[model samples]
Target: MSAKLTFLGHSGFLIDDGATTLAIDPFLTGNPKATMSAEEVRCQFIALTHGHADHMGDALAIARRNDANVIAAFEICNYFEEKGHGNVNPGNPGGRIDTEFGWVALTQAFHSSSFEGRYMGMPCGVVAHIGDKTIYHLGDTTIFRDLELIGEIYRPDLVLVPIGDRFTMGPELATRAAEMIGAPRAVPIHYDTWAPIEQDPAQFAPQGVEVEVMQPGDTLQLD
Candidate 1:
């Protein structure tokens, strides 16, 4: 099977690349748009972009239930281990970890990383190469000049970005990010979860790029 991406509300996503099933930032339990419960979600690997409650929500619970490996920054990994989840891949920015399916590279993300009164390290994004396709998930971040470099390095086929302002990039900046990333297709995320970060996807559809405005449970097939 080709790489399939499903938006799981907020910053959460389920990615199936035939060999391995991966979930990212599982904030579904409390999210209104979430389709699956923490128990209903299945994945071989659970990747976190940061240590915020919203981003790391339901991660330990879901990973424990499914016996999945949790991937995140070193500081966040320590927190997971303290919670008795030993299967953690503590990675740093610019590092790549090998998984059963492919390689996942930790990239820089302009966001804070703290959760549950605990302070983790810096936040990060992910560049995953599965089969012939490369996917970029920009976990709660702002638009940066290095995005152009990331685009040149990974040349991702699909990019999952945040269009929710207040905390992350809004529609206007996110549109510029799409161009900077130069991905074939881009999907908006982390919007409409709360009043502070509400945004409309249509306002961020960049010209010449395939913009997919997916709802909570919508799934997209990646080439």
Candidate 2:
């Protein structure tokens, strides 16, 4: 089986493996760079890496509308459950949630996780395995050496890197992260969506890795 990954701007992505569709960090509602509306988002599962507003954008509404299973950290899932969304799978760093499509695993991320002053659990990078392909979505975080270990274990086909500075790694650091992960291909995210984090995608260059700078709504086919 094959899968299609569509960039939803920032760190959001829609991965569809023909039968199941999964949404990751879907922050489309108020996202200026988003090409699609929340109502247009259709998925059977939604995975969130953190509780930041931008990262959890429209997840509640989208999950309710689609009756999608929400996969996130323990605190995040509890929050959704309290709001009446019962279909939730909660896991923390070093934990993996099994699903029909395959599985979703959480990895430690060097960042904070909170929304409206409430602690939302640890921020994390998402490693998703679907359609016989693995995708590593490195949620908002600074450069860390453990990325190399993650790459060796999951062997992701594609890696989503954050090059938006201030809150996350800039192009220079992200470039090194790409090298450490050693993924064959990577996509730059978490930038160009706002002024504070604005960055030139071309600046991210990692040796021996192919970087695909995708615009919002751009789709990449993965085998």
Candidate 3:
């Protein structure tokens, strides 16, 4: 079997690559459109792209319960570590950290970072190589030119993009982002979770790119 990636609603996902389970931006608890809860999640590594409450949802609880390594920006890690999380892997943009599963490389994201008014660190995107595939999760950000550079360097097979306009890129911009990254396949996330960010995934169409509109409980197999 290849790797199984389950969409945990919003920007959250669980990737089981036979050897390791990596969870990214698991914001299920207070997510209005979420179909799952943090209690049901089990992963070896938890990767947070930013410091928003929605993006950081249930990470501490799930990490504490599963003894998973929480990976995020430097200050974000410190925040969680001080909050009693036993394991924390701090990282920064333009750097890569190798892990048992594979590797996670940080990239520049055009966004802000803060949690409850506390500084969390620079918001960044993530390039994760797990199981048999490579995924580029473009955290919460507007369209930027660096995405092309990331794609050129990593050559991710699948890409996850945020299509929510108020806080991130809208469908039109996200479609352009897909073209810039040149990934074979892409998934639309971080949309339809609230009123301001609500978007229709079908409306986003990038030429020569296959867009996967994943539901809250859907899973995608990549090998």
Candidate 4:
């Protein structure tokens, strides 16, 4: 089976495998680059990487409207539950949450997680398996050596890397990270949203890999 992966801008994505659809970090409400609104998103599941406003944007709204399951760190799930969304699948770094399509695993990320002065949980990178393809969304983080090991373990066909500076790895380091992961293909994310994180995608070139610079609403087919 093949999956259609749509880039929802600024680290957000929609992955659909025909039977099930997932929204990862669906931050569209305040996204200047987002072409679709929160109400336009349709998914059976919502998987979040952290609790930042941009990353967690419109998750609850979309989930509640669609009655979708929320997947994220344990604290994030608890947070949502407190907000009245009871259907959640919680996991933490080094843990995996099973889903109908496949599974969602959280990996360590060098970043912080919080929302409205509350400690959400450890920030994480998500590895999701849908159909026969695997996707690694490296949330928000600085370049780390473990990415190579992560690549070896999951061997994802595609990887989503953050190239924005100040908050995460810049273009130069992100290129190294993509090379380290050694995925056949990679997509640049979490950049060009704000002036602080502005970047040129052309600066991100990983050897032996195809770098796809996706714009808002761009979709890719993974088989």
lDDT leader:
2
Mind giving the per-residue lDDT tens digits that candidate 3 earns over 132-189?
6899999999998878888899999999999989899999999999999999999999
Clash pairs of candidate 4?
none
Candidate 4 lDDT, tens digit per residue, 1-223? 9899999999999999999999999999889999999999999999999999999999999999999999999999999999999999999988888889999999989999999999999999999999779999999999999999999999999999999989999999999999999899999999999999999999999999998889999999998
Give the residue spans of candidate 4 off by over 4 A.
none
Model 2 misplacement above 4 A: none
Please report how far candidate 3 places residue 171 from its true position, in Å. 0.4
lDDT of model 3, residue 199: 89
CA-lDDT, candidates in order: 0.89, 0.96, 0.91, 0.95
Candidate 2 structure quality by residue, lDDT tens digits, 5-90: 99998999999999999999999989999999999999999999999999999999999999999999999999999999999999
What overall lDDT, based on C-alpha atoms, would model 2 receive against the true structure? 0.96
> Compared to the true structure, candidate 2 yields what TM-score?
0.99
Pairs with backbone N, CA or C atoms under 3 Å apart (clashes), candidate 2? none
- RMSD of model 3 against the true structure: 0.9
Worst 10 residues of 1 by lDDT: 28-37
* Residue range 98-132, candidate 1, lDDT tens digits: 99878789999998989877788989998887766
Q: How well does model 3 score by local distance difference test?
A: 0.91
* Candidate 1 deviant stretches above 4 angstroms: none
